[model samples]
Target chain A: MKTIAALCLWEERIAPRYDRSQKVLVVHLDHGKAVEASTIAVEHLDREELCKTLIAMKINTLICGGVVDPCRRTLEQAGVKIIDNVIGSPQAVLSRHLAGALSSGTVVD
Target chain B: MKRLQTPIPPELILDHLAVGVFTVDPDFLITSFNAQAEELTGFTRKEALGRRCYEIFRADMCFEGHCALRRAMDSKSSIVRERANILDKRNQERPVEISAAVLRDKTGAIIGGVETIQDDSNRAALEKQVKASYSFGDVIGKSPAMQTLFEALPVLSATDSTMLILGETGTGKGLTARAAHNASPRREGPFVKVNCAALPAPLLESELFGYRKGAFTDARSDKPGMFELAHGGTIFLDEIGEMDIGLQAKLLQVLEDKEFYPLGGVRPVKADARVIASTNRDLASMVREKRFRDDLYYRLQVAQLELPPLRERREDIPLLAARFLQEQGALEGHTARGLSSAALKLLMEYGFPGNVRELRNILEYAAALKPGGRIEPADMPRYLLRIDCPPAGAQRAAAAETAPQSDSTPDPTPERSETERKAVTDALHQAKGSRSETARLLGISRTTLWRKMKQLGLGW
Candidate 1:
């Protein structure tokens, strides 16, 4: 099944913490194939607003690093998969996702 | 203090330093992490090296364009000393003091950045003296009411009886419960909590007592409740007053029998858990209204403890305010150092309807509005300043109506500026009219204090 994922960004690397991320790279996938990708600025959004934005955008999963309860719970309740405490570039993480070898707390060099 | 003439290796010196030291490349990757850095951040040097600073440290300042190292490297500037909070590997939000400076080669080209970190958890506690003389867990107090409560805590924790904690909202009822559990014989066991008001009666009942597979339409497998999870430990039922009348009967049964039947199960499970309940509601009134069960109330209150509100313990205001100001971690920059005398006086005179929680909210709001330095009366919320300051121990502002009609009588309840003037005057007198000494007494710079004195016409 195809899905949409948002990779929290810090420059070119995945943001270490989702709560502090100012930007997110959203990628659309279809059967392990990349369909589309775009960058969205998220600095102005608070925790609630950020969750609402992700849910409203039809985002199915969030790829990021550390995430506390409030943000994690809100996203989880909205049926979004939160893969957290991850490290490495967004491209490498997304590639690993396609290879079916990615999960929470995964560290990619 | 004399400078040692001995020259030490930079690596040896960095390893021996008390503060955590780390250097990052321009790509935001960690180049080096010292021994102290590894211990303080709960990550080994091998795990931290070559990783992003944020991935290893997880400092709160790293998010939303506030990365301390990034800011220093980009601006070609240095953060000499700043406060931050970091989540360690244990998921503990530890307070840290950070200093970051951009690294430059001999050619003056920017290379990377170096950051030094100090665990400020202990320092802040000692510096503010919030964990002062009388503290039970994180709950701190020094008043007679609190002192008596402190004296009784040992006795309360020495037993295994069900304890009911009564207090107004946000009065540390949960904190007291935790303190009791920490001091109890079951300290090694699990501590579970459930807010009866947060869930519906049916869901709350399921949450308190386990259910078996096929117990209900959606019951896929065996699910253990909070009571089961808290085996050999303590279960804190927060806001127990909100428990439904029907569920209260079931709870009453559990308290009496120490065993309960999981839904749709024939076998009974023994509850080896100690129960501690807390509420801000008047359970007695609820009993009269038939909203709460009297049997359950009696069972829960076998060992009851009452917590005093913030107004009654006004003597601890300064200490609490100082602590709250230091706790303003999520703010953009440095937290407020301390409250000015006028601000302290204002806080003491005002009645806190929301208690300690409200006090913290007010200080956090003030600190966010105005970044670093001492918080003044002007920084307080308008709601706080709008209310009339009453005389100590008085419920209402009767001073203005009851005071003698003479300027010589002194303002029975002086306004903010008047209070500030009196504080300065007293400091000047104590310092023997020395401007520098007076400034030291008031915890302000000589120039700032002198300007205030001149502006207010104190004639010092």
Candidate 2:
């Protein structure tokens, strides 16, 4: 099962309206696979919108820098898992997610 | 050069003086003693005149050591305002302030010393009483842990830092918090407490942060919250882990900024009260599981104090039991008696999962049940007696009662314990084997459940 999907804000900033253009990222995980989707940019998105996007994609896992209650609740309602709040490259978070050793909701800063 | 002078009566002059005056020779012998001196020493001049001052007075001071009269005579100068102890004829030692001056003749040669004494024993007694009254009494515990706790109390009492007291239900966490408050600089201020788990989220919030008029259905008038009431004092948050996650965030914000808004009010009110939070739950585990907030956990853990469980400190059981008996007996208007050695032994041997609280409840039950007499092992609860017996009989009885009656054929099982074992194993696997949570779900005390788990060798 793809248990987690990464949302990269750095990529969205360089590519204008990147979220609207490509709403989902499908990645293979160790135990499974995951689909990540969001209507708003990862950096500018509030917790609720982020949660809605994750729910829409049927994704239960996420990796992001900062999150608020709306995003937390939406993800929780969708049974989506959140990994450590990653600050660096999104690829590192994806790697940890594949290893199944990643601790969720941990502030990585 | 003949001048005839009128003689003045020394007795008349001495009798009218207020100060206790006496004359001592170079050998420290009492010579001329005035009426006041005789009254002060509880001796007549006739009895004191020829005796040594030390022998007559028997003061704590000796003539062989530092005597003000001797120093005054030796130096041929006034030795004024010296403090010492003096013994009266009745053998009562009194603190006396003495002023000794060297008596000189017309040629300026030192003759004897004249000393004045004033009793100061009353002042000394008053000082002693003040010192004795400041000690915190009746709070008994001499163990090293308690001693260290008492020693650290002053430091805790001196500050306004948030304190977290972690202990089982009956370890007197509430009492400790009160003690800390009473010992602190805010002793005169209010000590308010809120049971976080007892109230619903909305009510708990309104109770904590106050509410404006017409804020809710029953909130007809503006009422001050515990925070407002506890201004310049302390607010104890009990069972803090049970507080709702949403309120936890608000509480965290208030702790960080020392300001909170009322339920409906727009203006922020500054909170000056110190916070003391307590819980028996494994909060770190809760945080790890995301049941509790991490930021709130760190904020409340400024100065953490963990109280050891009653079973861990069984030495205090007897004392606590005795105190409880006395308290309960006093309240009930009955004579408090000691517990039988066997009963006490039973209590000490039993592992109390509820901690001090459980012990107290047991004692209260025993006290209530014992018909105006001493408590014995038989007087204890039935569950206590069952601890020694294995669960095989109960398990068989339960299985026999619950088994299907109209089964076509009875397949012989090894034993009911085997079935119970299998059921427990399945439950553990289904619950992801979280022992603490399993204990909660199984409707058994953690200690009892843990014992069962250990017996079944249910490893994490």
Local distance difference test values of all predictions, in order: 0.80, 0.66
CA lDDT, candidate 2, residue B340: 97
Candidate 1, residues B245-268: lDDT per residue as tens digits? Answer: 889999999999999988877899
Clashing pairs in 2: A1-A31, A1-A32, A1-A33, A2-A32, A2-A33, A2-A34, A47-A71, A60-A80, A60-A81, B170-B357
Off by over 4 Å in 2: A1-109, B1-140, B389-460
The DockQ scores of all candidates, in the order shown, are 0.35, 0.00
lDDT of candidate 2 over A19-106, digit per residue (tens):
2112334453445443443344343443345456567766556655333444455566678765523433345555555666566332
Instruction: State the lDDT of candidate 2 residue by residue for B320-383, as single tens digits.
Output: 7888788888767687687999999888886654555666767776787884589998877555
Which 10-residue window in model 1 chain B sums to the lowest lDDT? B397-406
RMSD (Cα, Å) for all candidates, in order, is 15.8, 34.9
Clashing pairs in 1: A65-A85
Retained true contacts (fraction), each candidate: 0.33, 0.00
- Model 1, DockQ value? 0.35
